[model samples]
Target: MRSVAITGTRATGHRPPDEYGAIFSAYLRPFADGHFYIGGAKGIDSLALLWLAGNSAAHLTVVVPGTVLHQPTEAQQAIARTRERIQDVVELGAAELDTPAYHARNRWMVDHASMTIGFPHADEPEGGTWQTLNYTAEQGKPRLIVPV
Candidate 1:
């Protein structure tokens, strides 16, 4: 499987829906032919999951740092909205939902996938998103960096 791990920011309110649609179309469409490992968070994760669910036939996996119920209501709702289309929901079952737990989740995805694509907020540089990208690079895999 051509697995791709997608890591991005949770803040996407700056762009309109149409703009994000176009961005996904241009950057994510080509990679949508295979399986995807997406963090089950708000913003890019939820957006890309919905887009791929509707627009492609790829297998989708949503990986959460903890149980789905532990996530924010919005994230849980997003997963619920597209439950039928998702192929897997991986809950790492971390006791505490913190930065390290999230970083561990990101590392898990990178370890499972061959490539990574990150959509970081333009101004932001350090976080789980960037850490994921760095791990991907450390693995000597291809990485597509797109700042939104």
Candidate 2:
């Protein structure tokens, strides 16, 4: 199965706001059968996880900087409840959870996927999302940006 990596900003909240939800839903509709790889972070990552749990038939793999317990409470709960639906949960070694850990996780996702979907702020234009998309470009992977 093809895999699509999801990378985005952490500013969207646990549940995406209305506008973001619309964009996210639209962007994900075509990937119903694709495997989703996401960093188990607080904002966009958790929002994507919840969206997939409710809308898509795709398998999900959450790549974490540390243990699942290290994720935001909302993400942890969602993963626990939907454990059966998820295909895999990858936890990085403890030493990898520092400032650069999120970048590492992003690279892991990008390396494993065929394409990447990103939600980035055009104004701010910098963060993990930007870094991941840059990596995706360097790897010559296709990218779909959902402007937020």
Candidate 3:
């Protein structure tokens, strides 16, 4: 099966209720048989993970910057429930939630996947999500941007 990486903004301030889950499911449906690669961050990452846990048959690999402990409480709960289904948990030994480490983790996801699915904010043109999308394009990988 192919691998598809998921990346998006960490901010949930403007996300409408249930919108993220709907968008994530729609974007992921095409890759239902593929493995999913995601950084276990809050916001979109956690939302995607929860959606995948309930909706897809795909294998999951959560690539964390440091440890699972660093994840948001809700994400940690979701991971615990879906622990049996996860194929791998890659801890990249990041000392903290620094920009460089997150960027490195994003690159790792983009490099490993056949394509990337992103939830990006058009207004914010220079964040990690945008950088990951740019990297995906630079790598010549297929990318799908779910408009929020």
- Report lDDT per candidate: 0.93, 0.84, 0.86
Measured with C-alpha atoms, the lDDT of residue 18 in candidate 3 is: 86
What is the total number of backbone clashes in candidate 1? 0
Better-scoring candidate (lDDT), 2 or 3: 3
Clashing pairs in 3: none
- Residue-level lDDT of model 2, residues 1-148, one tens digit each, is 8899998877764343676668767998788688999888777887788788777889899999788988788778878877888889999855656768878888999999999999876665787898899999999999998867
Model 1 misplaced regions, further than 4 Å = none
- Per-residue alpha-carbon lDDT of model 3 for 1-112, expressed as tens digits? 8999999877766978487767776778779789999888877887788788788889999998888998788778878888888889998989978999999999999999
Q: What C-alpha lDDT does candidate 3 achieve relative to the native structure?
A: 0.86
lDDT of 1 by residue, 69-116 (tens): 998887898899999999999999999999999999999999999999
Candidate 1 lands at a TM-score of 0.98
TM for every model, in the order presented, reads 0.98, 0.90, 0.92
Model 1 clash pairs are: none
lDDT of 3 at 45: 84
Number of the predicted model whose lDDT against the real structure is largest:
1
